[model samples]
Target: MTSVRVAGVGLTPFGDHGDRAGRDLFAEAAAAAIDDAEIDRAAVDQLAYGNFMGALAEQQGHQAPLMAEAAGLDCPATRYEEACASAGVAVKAAVEAIRAGTADLVVAGGMERMNCLDTGEATEALAIAADELYEVRAGMTFPSAYALMAQAYFDRFGGGRADLAHIAVKNHANAVPNEYAQYQREITVDDALDAPPVAEPLHLYDACPITDGASAVVLASEEYVTANDLDAPVEITGVGQGGDRLALQDRDAIAETPAATEAAEVAYADSGITAADIDVAEVHDCFTIAEAMALESLGIADSGEGIVAARDGKTTPDGDCPVNLSGGLKAKGHPVGATGGSQIAELTRLLRGDHPNSEHVADATTGVAHNAGGTVASAVVHVLEVAE
Candidate 1:
């Protein structure tokens, strides 16, 4: 199979875009990506887009063609939705298409608009990602679902809210230098501990904000890169996805995310690298505890030890393996469908030595991006190498 390179990437600042249309956000990101790639839009062979709640948010469906037109692209457009992992899977499809020789130049990304809706409306819309008959009916919102996971972790292991608070402080600090982050200011551990509780053990600072944003990536095959004389240096070497039961009740263990473990296992094997080889990472951190769980599942931290990875300075930017140099979904904002693409875009820039926080990992050669959907029911992992 031919290698796939991240030729270019674009992102709309992750925050509230008042009255902005989803397609409008996507168009800006896509155009920026195309411009960065220095490739004629005419060379694009396909478009893979992701949006989670267009129908509910804007009453607009059949968004693939609409986004393609908005982005000034004329090509076969496809939409992939796996909750918050939407854009990750979209990019994964782009990589597979190029690897299969079905297309060389493809645009993959996602957009999400949540600020347009009231908090209640947006929460209900997002709840559809869970099992409606089971989890949703029981009044289980994401904050609470994640709270259960936190409690499970504390029960099985031994940690408190103080441990999760460290993650919030670390991510917020990281976001200060990230132009695309939602919350770019630092917070103290005491501030996090004292913040209003969203759910027990998870305070306001511990959870990611509901955000509106978009991100896009231009990917090309190695053959296309050489043939077109592109200067792409970051290559997507591995992609893997795994799924678990949709309902939180059906899962065997709430504390452990088997899906992410499975996906990381496959991605690691595919990339011929282990977790120890990962110099940096950007994992889904919709909540502080989620990041801890992700670290464990991805093998960066052993079970029970993941909770304190941030507090121990292990996942800090100056630490052994910095995670979420883009601030992660925690302080970077969670625009649902768009976050996955944003993670990849941030990684591409960091690996390319263009990110504000790249100095932390200046000698890094390999990085990982992990995206997950609803309670870790869906997970997608990608491995990137500095091909330069």
Candidate 2:
């Protein structure tokens, strides 16, 4: 295989896009990324788009072609959907395409226009990822599914609502300065305590908002980067992915994400760096419980101790091994498909010294993006470094 380098990254603001469609949002972000790369659109040999609800939201299928025409690109296109992990999967596809010598330059991105639906309609749309035979029939929503995991973790361990609330406070505080984040204001512990309940243990604050946004990145082969004089490229050092049983009932333990653990093992091995070496991370925080679980799953913290770590300010924006400096999906908004690319864009900015929240992981040279699809059914872990 060959090495891949990220040449440019682009992102749309994370919030409600009143009337913008997925095609429009994606095209705008893709154009910015291509421009940022200082490359011609015609040079792109492939396009990979990440979106979970094109069929539901836009009543549009064949998304890749739609996006291609919108972006005015004539390359072969592929649409990727791994639920919330869509953009991460698209990023992985772009990397693999370059590594396999199938394409030297590829544009990978994600877009979601979720503001079109009301809460009930949105919940129904998201329910498609659940097990129709079991989960959906049981009237379980995403928050309820994750709330089950939270309840199990608390039962097995000793934490409670207070621990989860702390995670909210910290990430909210971190989101204050993130201009692109969905929730940009800081919230107090009382604010968290008073938020409307979404699920028993998960509240409005604990859950990410339905956001509409898009993000894009340009990936090129190492040979292409060198020949084209791509400046300040970030090297894709390691990539790992794993999948698990879709239904939560099939798992032996809700506290553990076996797919995440396996992916982390491969990421650590391939990157030649342990969790200790990672200066910063952008992990999936679709729910506050997932944030704590992710720290453990990534081996950044021991199992059942992620709450303690968060409570102790160990995962604060300026804390050691800061996680989710982009305000995370918690504060940054989970635009379903666009989330993973959003993480990469934030990390890329951090590496380029363009990010204002430099204190999160100052002097950081290594970064990680841990993305998961539908209740840990799929996961992709990536390690990156400042290119040589």
Candidate 3:
């Protein structure tokens, strides 16, 4: 067995790229990551890429080989897609390959181009990630689905829109200094509350925007890192993936994400730590309610208690276990496939003391990244620790 080290991380700005092709975005991110790794480009043995809607957005179903060429790599490339968790699974596969001794170095990441599509086209494209027969045909957009979750939470757990707004405000504040973030301007709670309603309970401010971008990370085995003297300071100590009923109607509870809970538990066990050991987190916050759900799954908040954590000042930057210091998807931008890799990239920089938000978690030694697909029907969790 071998440890996986994140030798380098890179991300294109997480916002609209106008007419830039997906390949072009991925190429820039891959090049930046390879450059940051400071290793011979030829040493990279494989590429694990991810994209969710390339066929619809760019008419490219086979994105891995195209991206491999675009990134100027001469290695076998494989593509993984689990909707929003696409990059996460790709990274996990790259780690597994390194640990299995089948590869010494690998590049893992994802790219998404949503701004190119019209609003209706993009919504329809994203809806394909849901259950087509049950959810899509019934006209359940992500916002409406999350809104139902929020309503269910309020019905069962006793929180309201105000609580969720705090999460939006907190994440927006965190994004202000993040150069790659889409909406760096902070929003007040009132602003979030007053924003136009996308759904009953989820307002415009509560949801992540349609972003277009790419992110990449270079991974090396412990042996490769030592043999090459790579300056990698972040180690991926644990990885886990979990899945549940795909449709919300089939789930036991509409407000909870058991898949995320299962993934978090397994990842924590793999890392030889409990949830209490987590010092920071970057979670899937496609909607504000999702941040609460993720925190509960990670045990940062007790069941039914996550919704108020931000409002209560428990999950804020100065709190005991700060979360989403990169502003999260709520403000940092959610470029579908690229978001998972972006979370890991942001966490690596924060752990390495290079991110603008690092000061908030200066003493943090361990962190978690959680990504989910399709209302968290599928989820991936990874534990990262500063190298000893």
- TM-score each candidate: 0.99, 0.97, 0.99
lDDT of 3 by residue, 163-183 (tens): 999999999999999999999
25-93: candidate 2 lDDT, tens digit per residue: 988889888888888788899998999987888898889988988887999999999998888989988
Q: Count the backbone clashes (under 3 Å) in each candidate.
A: 0, 0, 0
Local distance difference test values of all predictions, in order:
0.94, 0.86, 0.94
lDDT per residue, candidate 1, 1-388, as tens digits?
9999999999999999999999999999999999889898988999999889989998999999999999999999999899999999999999999999999999999999999999989989999999998889999999999999999989999999999999999999999999989999999999999999999989999889989999999999999999999989999999999899998889898999999999999999988999999999999999999999999988999999999999999999999999999999999999999988999999999999999999999999999999999999999999999996
Off by over 4 Å in 1: none
Candidate 2 wrongly placed segments (more than 4 Å): none
